[model samples]
Target chain A: MKILLLAAPCLLALAVPLYNSDSPRLFGFPFFYWALIGLVPVSALFIYAVFKMDGGK
Target chain B: MIAHLNWTATLVFVAFFALVTGLGFIAGRWRAGDLDDLAEWGLGGRRFGAWVSWFLIGGDLYTAYTVIAVPAVVYAVGAYGMFAIPYTILIYPLLYLTFPRLWAVTRAKGYITAADYVDGRYGNRWLALAVALTGILATMPYIALQLVGMEKVISALGFEGGPWASHLPLTIAFIILAIYTYQSGLRAPAMIAFVKDIMIYIFVIAAVIVVPLKLGGYGAVFDAAGAALAKKAALSGKPAGLTLLPAQIMPFITLAIGSAMALFMYPHSMTGILAANSGTAIRKNAYMLPAYSLVLGFIAIMGYMALAAGIEVKNPQDVVPQLFLKMFPSWFAGFAFAGIAIGALVPAAVMSIGAANTFTRNVWKPFVDPGIGSKEEADLAKLMSLIVKVGALIVILVMPTTFALDLQLLGGVWMIQVFPAVVFGLFTRWFSGWALLAGWAIGMVVGTGLAAGPLAWTPVHAVFGLGFSAYNGLIAFVLNVAVAGALSALLPNTAPDATRAADYEDEALA
Candidate 1:
């Protein structure tokens, strides 16, 4: 969990469409396309942090 | 270069201010007590239900700054500004999971700020005091940002006075905010949000429908913008930052997550949560706030429209106003500016009250003299609120910070450090109060250092070199959580024996 948290930043980086200038398209959508698809997973991780945190009161 | 300053619109703004001030004085009696009860006066009797909470929380979440800045970022930054759209939407659902719990527990214990909850929950005076100090410090610039928003409208409308009077308009407007908020506490801003939200919805709906039509259409606007931005990027070797992609995924997500954490912990935000009638209302509001987030998505896109229209804004802050003026008539533009101007009023008032509440409870009562009566508490709260507004005014004029339009991107990094003690204590009793304090100190130091350090080229605003940055504040926040956890392991928990952290859970659950 500890190491995972530091790498947490790396996961957030995938939020941008990961594409080289050479790549034409993914599924007929541009780079922004793939990033939007990952939105839910990224959000889930953030929510998980909240749940995992000790105090909610 | 500037929108016409229609006296008629100016009169409308004045009338709105006068009515709000009148309402402010009258509000002293709306949720009246003996004039001594701090909670009753400072927080609107902590009895706010759906309607008032709707307005207060809405005003708390959205601001005049949102009216101008989001679109301005969209105008200036392009695709990167889209981050706020997702962040705003994400914030609502995020709050849905956490806010109700905080609300239920706060109301059950009659806590006012997050600090009050921190003190009561962990039975740790220092930890609570840390929360209080963080809130007061964080709120000063937030209030200053609202003043900056008002300045955007005043400047866009060309309300310049003498040259020596560069910021007179903002000074005058904030002075009004100071008086009204001091008099009515939460009620002033709570009422003003009604007008502000209505105007925002009107401006946003009009911008979505009319601006697109006037600019030839959303598709044309985006196509032109993407091409223009691409052309600009090709001409300039450096990264255009917003328009062009450059490994933005982690920064965007960190910005969102860190912002969401800071959002719930803010003093004024916590004030809205605590004032709710029930945990359910807070949750419901949390869900509904996304509705506003949907509007923010449109606001961010407006920046693109401005870019496509070749709309040249004099000041970066004028981007939204100039965009609206180009698309709308003078009369409709009046309402638009009204929306933006009054938008500053609501949160400005709430921030002042949140700061006042902290000073009265945390600094004044405990340190100065515990014997201070409830009446004195209300009185002192009112007084300190004045000082907060004045401090904000100084920041506006003296500091390099911009007006209500000011973007303290570093604010999120510094403010989020308070999370461990405020929100973390909400769920765990195993951590000692001293541990919370240690975590807070380390977090503040590390976050401040990270903000001041150079990690990458992403300085908070490119000016501070790579040393100061926005997203890295999350780095500090994570460290804060770690220090707290590690310290908790090292030190045994020491909350008073009478106060088991779970002892209040049943009441909250009820």
Candidate 2:
């Protein structure tokens, strides 16, 4: 279970076909650009969760 | 180039340089501690809180070259340059999993360098020496790149003169840096990091907002970059644009992952993590450090803005500096140049200290003289720090910028091979010390060979004739892990393990 949670972000990021396009612009950013930038915060939250859960150990 | 020099900007840069030099001198008294002890001098008494750690690590990681290079790559290549973004983002998760445990173990044992941990875990002096040597070798070029970053800023300000006049300013800047780092040690970089971070935020925030607004909007900037790439592609008769191509997908993923794994492996990064007050401080900063990555994402787009603004330079690394000079007022451009110049100094100081510590602790003490005391070690490290800075200056002045960049690229490939011994050793010690040594040897040879390309002599190109060419570091790392696993299973445990399992697991309890 711990391994699964850690692996999720790597999987989401490496799944290039999911976010490899020029459409779906956000605030003038392309889909490809915005999606990757969006993942920065999401990955940070996942890391926070990992840290919190480990502290409970 | 001479026409581009703005006296107002040069004055602003000089003023900031003087202010930082003053801070560097006074940092000796900040957070007063025993200067004689290696820990106090090398790691700033290992007492950095989360706030200080945040800026220190941020300034150390997001360097001056990064400020210049990331945007320059984006301007040259398109989405391919955004590899730095995912690499930076994913590094936090990697650090979250690895560094707290590393910090805990190192703190428990009073270890100053990663090689010290390797020696403690494996009970093999030779293995520790390998790690120490790799850290020092890799750090030299990394420092040289920082010099390259400063040289770009200096030259972009149109300070053309004879070769001696061209290099004189950098020489004086580095001399001041070496003296303060010698006197104040880690406190110097940590204290000055506050000023560096504030200036970077100001420059990046202003550039992102003001530059895009000056040239209509973000949409127009992107369109201009796209048009420029399309024209280049048409001329070259190849597919290229503002988005990633299918063939580029694999290289992009591999480069990003390889870089993330290698980031914390550098000695300076470990110095930053170990200097923190506790395991919790390290973890907290990992969560917050991605904020700098977000800033980097904005800075990368400024390369596109450079295209829209029609800035051109013979060297791509000068694109961002040239853009600032052309787009902003004289005073503000000077402020931007000062920010970049200071950015270079912070990392150079940290890298030199990190390399110096490895040399004094892992190499000199064990190999040369086991009777060395803490005071002697600190003094030796200070001397070595000056030597490392001088070495970096020579690398930049003697070599071309592209050659220095290739050396940094190869440094990553070489440094990552130590991971199985350092990071993985923190967990189970299933692999024997001899097996780990063998793995490192194989990784270094093959990684360097492939990164050196087909010539077996050239170290410039890293891509080889795989079905598709990829980052040589990742490919070599896979081979390293495989060889170690195989050797561990086949070979007997020839050497005794020096550390117990509880030593690693107990860190969680703290």
Candidate 3:
């Protein structure tokens, strides 16, 4: 379960087919641009979840 | 040789530099610990809580070169330079999984360097020494790149003089850094990192918002950058624009993943991890550190803004600094330049301390004096820190800045080779010391040759005739793991393992 959560971000970010484009702009950022920048928060959330599950406190 | 020397910027830079120097000196007493011990001096007493660790590691990782160079590349190329984005983002997950275990084991063993952990895990002094040597070799060039970052900011501020005049400020800055780091090892960088991080956040956030609005808006900035790349592509007969080409996808993914793997392998990063107060602190910082990457994403756009502003610099690395000079008022520009200059200092201090600790603990203690006391070890580390700083200064002064930058790239290629030994060894001792050593040797030789030869220096292209070039480090890493796995199964264990599996698992509770 932990490994699956950890691997999700890497898979989504690096898969190439999912985000390699200039269309589908969000807030004027191309899909490629916004997707890469957007992943920062998403990856952080996954890491935070893993930390919480690990009893990080 | 001063082109557009703005007194306001120079004064602001000087004032902030003076303030940080004062903080550097006073850092000796901050958090007051046993100054004579390596743990106390070299690792900041190994007691950094989440907040301090956050700022320290943030300041250490998002360096002056990163701030200057990332935008520079983005401005010069296109989406390719944003490789730093995914690399920084992915690093947290990897760290989340690895650093807590590393911190637990190192803290339990009282090991100050990764090589110390290697020695304990495998009971082989030679394998440990290999890790130590790789750490020092990789770190020196990284330290040189920080000096190069300082030099670029200095030159951009119109201080390009006869070699002596231009380098004088950098020399003085490094000398002050060497002294304070000598006096108070890791504490100096940790304390000054607060001032540096604040300055960076203020200026970088300001640049992202102010620079785009000055040149109309984000749409205009992208259009301008796209037009510039299209023009260049026509002349060079290569595809270029605001988007990545189909061929670039593989290289981009491999570069990001390869670099993420290599980031924590560097000795300075490991130093930051080990300095945290607890395993929980290490884990918490992993989640928090990505905030800097968000800031970096904003900073990356400043490169696109530079294009829209049409700022011209001979060296692409100078584009962001030149962009600041063009876009902002004199006083604010000075603040930006000062931010870059101070950004260089924090990482240099941390890196020198990391390299010095690797030398003192791994090399001197084991080889020079097997029974070296804590006080003497601290003294040796202090001296080595000064030597490493001076050595980097000499390299920066004598060599072209591009050479240092290339060496910095090569440092990553060299460092990733150690991942099999250090990161892999943390999980399982399935590989013997001899196999790990052999893998490391082959990886270093082949990785250096591939990265430094055609890929870096020569006109010839294509890495390993793969038709599409990828990050040389990743290629070498795959080979390193393959050789180690094969050799581990084929060969007998030459040295009996001193550390048991329970030692690694027990770190979870540490």
Candidate 4:
């Protein structure tokens, strides 16, 4: 269960064909660039949640 | 043709360098411990809290070369270079899952290097020797390559002379680094890591915000970068785009996964991971270390920013330095250059210590001296660390730079072969030691042969009638696992397990 949560970011991010477009610019940045940059924090959150679930204080 | 040294910039660079030198030397006393103990000297006594581990590992992994090279790649090849982004993003969860288990086991069993753990688990000295030798082979060249990053900044600061004399500043800086590291051990880099990371954070964040604003914001920068890439593509008749070309998608993802797998396999990364105070510290760092990735994302973007700024240099590695020189004031450029040079110093220290630790614990003690005392072990590791650094320095000064770069290229492919032995053994003792050793041997030859022979040192190659190309390391790793699994099913387990199943559990959970 914890492994699934942690693998979320790796799966979603490495699927380059899905989100490789320059369209849907975020604040003057392309979707491809901004999305990957934004995923950095999201990936951290997923790992943090797994940590908390594992009885981490 | 060397440019004139800017006095203001040189002074700022010197000031920062001197400050870090003092920190490096004083670090010996910072976390007071018996320097005679190999654990203390090699792993900082495993006393680093979550935050300190974050800085130390962050500074260790995202090296000065990474700071320079990531942007250089983006500058040279457009969005293809952003493979490092996904690679960094993918690495954290992998760390979150695997490394805590490694920390727990190593703590319980007093295993200093991954090879030591392999020896303990498999009870096979030959297999452990393979792991250790592969580590040293991969890392020694890496230490030399760190100097390439420092040399870039040193020359950029306009320190010029004859060939030997021109490298004098870099040599002097490394000598100071070697001395403090010898005196202090892991703490030297760990302490200096604090300053190195802060300087990097300041400069990268400053560049991210200030560079875009200087170039009239992200929109103009991307447009200009796209235009520039398109112009280059037209001239070269090769596909380049603001986004990934269809043909590039496979290599990009494969490179990302291959690199993430290889990153922690290196002994230096293991050194930083093992130095944490507890499994929870390593776990906490999983979420925290991505902050550096965010910094790296911005750093990668600077390559595009360099294009927008019309900065031209014969070498792409100079893009970041050139960007700073053109965009920022002279003094701040100096500060940025110092940040990069010190960045190089931290990893070189850690890499040498890591390889040296592998030699002392895995090779020398087990093979050379069965009853070596802790003090002698620590002393030997210290001496070995000095030798590794001097050897790397000589490699840089005497040999052509491409030799080190080529070896480093093979280094990744070679290092990943150790993965199945170390990481696989973490979860299951089902695989036989001999099987794992055979797998490693086959993987090394195949990976190196393909990389050096047919692939021509390119990272990705077309595999087995698959139209798409994949990273050679990943391809080799798959073959490694297949061979190990097939042989494990056939061969009886010969070596008894040294660690119990519970040994892999964190203390809080256990």
Question: Whole-model Cα lDDT per candidate?
Answer: 0.69, 0.86, 0.85, 0.92
Candidate 4 docking band: high
* Candidate 2 Cα misplacement greater than 4 A, ranges: A55-57, B1-4, B237-239, B454-466, B505-510
Model 3 lDDT per residue over B81-123, tens place? 8888888878988888788887877877889899999998888
lDDT (Cα, tens digit) per residue for candidate 2, span A1-57: 656666677778878879999888887778888888888878777777877877732
Q: Could you give candidate 2's per-residue lDDT for residues B1-510 as a string of tens digits?
A: 356566899999999999999999999899899988889988999989989999999999999999999998888878888989888877887786788778877777889999999998888989899999999999999999998899888887778887778887888999999999999999999998999999999999999889889988887888898998788678887655779898888788888888888889899998988899877787787678988998899899888888889887777788988899888998999999999999998999999999999999999999999999888989999999999999999988777777778888889988889989998888778887888888889989888887765543332233556555567788888888998899899986667766665555434445
User: DockQ order of candidates, best first?
Assistant: 4, 3, 2, 1
Lowest summed lDDT across 10 adjacent residues in model 3 chain A is found at: A25-34
* Cα lDDT of model 4 by residue, B362-461, tens digit: 8999889999999999999999999999999999999988788888988998888999999888888889999999999989988887786553577777
Model 3 - which docking category? medium
Q: TM-score of chain A for candidate 2?
A: 0.87
The prediction achieving the highest TM-score against the true structure is: 4
Score candidate 1 by lDDT: 0.69
Q: Candidate 4, overall lDDT?
A: 0.92
What is the TM-score of candidate 2? Answer: 0.96
Report residue B408 deviation for candidate 4 (angstroms).
1.3
* DockQ, candidate 3, vs. native dimer: 0.67
Query: Candidate 3: deviation at residue B16, Å?
Result: 0.8
Please provide TM-scores, in order, for all candidate models, with all chains considered together: 0.85, 0.96, 0.96, 0.98
What shift in Å separates residue B172 of candidate 4 from its native position after superposition? 0.3
Q: After superposition, how far is residue B72 of candidate 1 from its true place, in Å?
A: 1.7
DockQ for every prediction shown: 0.10, 0.60, 0.67, 0.88
How does residue A14 of candidate 3 score in lDDT?
A: 85
